[model samples]
Target: MGTLVTGYVVLTAYLVEPDGPWDQQAVTNSKVAGAIGLVFSALMALLTMAFVRAGWLRKWWHAIPAALAITALLRLTLLAAEL
Candidate 1:
């Protein structure tokens, strides 16, 4: 999941700038968005693994929905920017 999200961000960023930096502003925005997605996904994966190992399955299960919501929100934000 983390990899998929990050890959999408990277791919989008590259596509958004196929030939060098189209504009500093666009590149900056893409980098920021990619960083946010990368950080959130990495943190969620780490927390999930830790929760599972610590026998917090119930809580982790509850958190999954929120994590997914954020993921969707992020995707929407990225797509919206492209448009």
Candidate 2:
């Protein structure tokens, strides 16, 4: 969840490029890195969630943070895209 949250924030920020905007190459590089981070984070999140559900883990509270992370990700992505 932490990874996801961080990934999402970082990815969104890269896309948003609020720091005086961004060049095409810079945006492309950032997107590549961000995509990798988001993919890994998503995989970890799903695995951990599955473990928790299957009684292999005991951290239910983590789900709350994951949910928040997803919400923030969605909001930031939407805002960045101006949609």
TM-score of 2: 0.46
* Candidate 2, 1-74: lDDT as tens digits: 55655556555545644333445655455555455555555666777788789888889746754654564455
After TM-score superposition, what is the CA distance of residue 60 in candidate 1 from its true location, in Å? 16
lDDT of 1 by residue, 1-83 (tens): 65456556545644554234345666566656655665665666677777778897655453553555465455445543341
Collision pairs in model 1: none
Give the residue spans of candidate 2 off by over 4 A. Answer: 1-22, 59-76, 79-83
lDDT of each: 0.56, 0.55
Query: How does each model score on TM-score?
Result: 0.40, 0.46
Highest lDDT against the true fold, candidate = 1
Clashing residue pairs, backbone N/CA/C < 3 A, model 2 = none
* C-alpha RMSD of candidate 2: 4.9
